[model samples]
Target: METTLHHLHRPLGSTGLNVSPLGLGTVKLGRDQGVKYPNGFRIPDDSQARQLLALARGLGINLIDTAPAYGVSEQRLGPLLQGQRDHWVVVSKVGEEFIDGRSHFDFSPAHTRLSVERSLKRLKTDRIELVLVHSDGRDLEILQHSGVYEALAELKREGKILGYGLSGKTVEGGLLALEHGDCAMVTYNLNEQAERPVLDYAQAHGKGILVKKALASGHVCLKSDEDPVRLSFELLFGHPGVGAAIVGTINPQHLSDNVRTAAAVLSQQQ
Candidate 1:
């Protein structure tokens, strides 16, 4: 019973990138401080990280999501992903940075350019596939007033990044981002449907929609004989605009189960 999602890869809007339905989020690979998971866990060591990556690839996961705000995630992935860069659709972020257990944000064009460059250096890659603005809950303000999206567009034209968008918190921000960007990462799950309009807009416009917090940030309540992960994926994959779901699980067993559940759910879609 080997699980795989190789054939379940979906298009990421008009960006011309195809990602697995379940993307492996690398926040736990390099940072454990101030996370919102149900329980605390140690960051995986080098060998362990390698095994986790191998498992992910074995399960046919091709999308890897990391961000500078994820502490040393970008830096750690640089060396870990040495020669297999082409195997994964690498996603990195700008605008939000975690420092000394506190989160800070900068949406200036200058900072946005600098952030992408730094991420490139840290990830040891020539170009990143996708670069998203890590919103600090000020979705509309950042998308409207801040020059972050403009800077991302410039980077896209310059070939530093193939596509750009926002990991936004509000529906208005997600809608506006889809208007000008390739993708929009929104919070979608059983607990929150406030951003459903954003997904509707993406579906109508052929824009990409990446779902974040699909399992309620690891706070999903358990019921007798019911699988929360499967339920979450059903809600996500049932939608037309969802390109992928970013699940930040560092545990190997959890990863395997997630891919298996996602594969089963997607199999029903066909």
Candidate 2:
């Protein structure tokens, strides 16, 4: 079987940004999972990370999602994508504090502005493609009162950010953001379709929907004995509301597998 994965392009909601159906997630790149791999798992060196990023680009994976809270993920991804920044879309989050050996949510306006500046420095980029408000499972009041959204709007206008979105842990948060946010990043999977209403609403309203935990945080993958992780990827891609799925993998073979799944889904759609 020739396993050269091909690209599948799609529109990213109403942003008019063309992206692949699948995107690279950099969460694990910043964390120490301590999980054993058959090929001896280890974090990729800078060169290795760059090589993988190149492979993703070649495979037509355009969006790369990262976060400051994800350990040193932003730092690792920044230099790797130095020159070819224009070829990919970068999405990051704010409204959270990661310092002093602890993590906490702080959506205050000052903290939000500080987060954007820090992310820009870490990304080594003059402008971010997308910046999302990282919600802390609180009521909508935090998002409204924190003034973070206003700051993000200002950044968008100043060209520091191309667009703004919200990442919420709950459907209510997603819904609120959809009604009031520019875009939404939500946890949507085959097992938990709670966000379906919000997804539909976003689609109808021309709001972008970037799906996270599409594989249920690896639960669906662990339960499967297949090549493509078919169920998880297919379920999300088949949904009309999902603009893109951000899946993570440090293994080259796993990356290839994800692209294969994306190609398969595109073929089925056609």
Candidate 3:
């Protein structure tokens, strides 16, 4: 029912970044301590991870999403992606860190600067294509009180980050961040659509939009005969401003299925 979809490289708003319709989220690649995934699993070893990354790229995936909150994901990718850095759009986040099976947040300007530098190191690269404030759901408070956005902007000016934004939870916070940053990553799936307004604002303002949990974080279960994945993808792709949907899956077949479903959706849209 689905085919290839490489023609769907969309612009990530005005940041001048182009990304495939589906992005590979790397949360499962690192953290397993407090994951909410419907299924429990082991973290893939480097060789397995490398295989998955290569398979993703072969399937026309160019956007790889990670964060300091994802345990060793950033660090592992640094070495695994050796000799192939520029081929991918590397996106990392600050403010949230996964440590000792617990999560912590630090949005101070100093920590922000330090975090960006650490990411550059762990990523084994000199520059990060995009960095976002990994908001702790108090998106508005973080935007107003925290110096994180300011720090990322300075880094962008210094050529450390090409652009910065908020992986915010609230629509208002996302819109607020876009006033200062390049894009916003928010949740938008069949099960949750409250944040659709953020996507609307990003579309209208020419700011970028990345969809997280677009498949309901692997919990979008439906009847055996129902094509939930296809329906969910259609809802996301319906928004022309959605640069990509960040789906985390360790299964190569699942990744290919997502790509094919996107292609089918794109075909119908045409």
Candidate 4:
């Protein structure tokens, strides 16, 4: 029998959103350029993408992460998720766009509002459950000078987004995001724990923390003989504020393995 994660869903802090511990990242579903993965991959076709989504759902994953910076991910998901909108907690991003094989960022309030609106149309959804600012390594500048957070907050008040936050790159940025927003997407894995202070703050303040690159962007298990995936999960769930880990795998077997590893680690925590 296959292990399922439905029983392990947890609250996303005070956002009133419950997400599975493992979220299926859809970057590979739209773009394959300039990614940091160890191995190169071909973008999956519609049939393959649909099967992948079904597989993820079967494994009890409800959180789906995407972004405009991920090429046509939002556009593809709009059509692909035709009838299953409510079944998943869709997380998309603003402030960054992948164009001409490069990344562009706009954190102004006007761009933020436009980006969220465009994402809604692209994803063919009434509202995105959570929208994050796709940071461009200028986390502090963006948070301070840019009115992006205020824009997202307005959208939340308008019911266009349930919650808003930042996919930040620094510990300070992550901490600031949780203070003014509902969650923070930080890089936390076996290899990098630099943003751990942000996780601690979230746990103390009742804010949500979503981990990105949980497996070090496919660079796991270099020094130890232990299972790399399991070690990654152990490090993640051991943290008190980590709500979910977004793993970007297009392969079915890898997805199943990830879910199983996460389930095992979480069960041990219980």
Best candidate (score: TM-score) = 4
Give the Cα-based TM-score of candidate 4 against the true structure. Answer: 0.98
Q: What is the lDDT of residue 72 in candidate 2?
A: 88
Better of 2 and 4 by TM-score: 4
Tens digit of lDDT per residue, candidate 4, span 172-248? 89988999999999999887899999999999999988999999988884667889999899989998899999999
Q: Candidate 1 — which residues are off by over 4 angstroms? A: 221-225
TM-score list, all predictions:
0.98, 0.91, 0.97, 0.98
- TM-score (C-alpha) between model 2 and the true structure: 0.91
Rank the models by lDDT, top first: 4, 1, 3, 2
Every model's Cα RMSD, please? 1.0, 2.8, 1.5, 0.9
Q: For model 4, give the 10-residue run with minimal summed lDDT.
A: 217-226
Best to worst by TM-score, what's the order?
4, 1, 3, 2
Better of 1 and 2 by TM-score: 1
Candidate 2's residue-wise lDDT over 149-212, tens digit each?
A: 8888888889898888888877777777877666788888767888788788888988889998
Winner by lDDT between candidate 4 and candidate 3: 4
Best by lDDT: 4
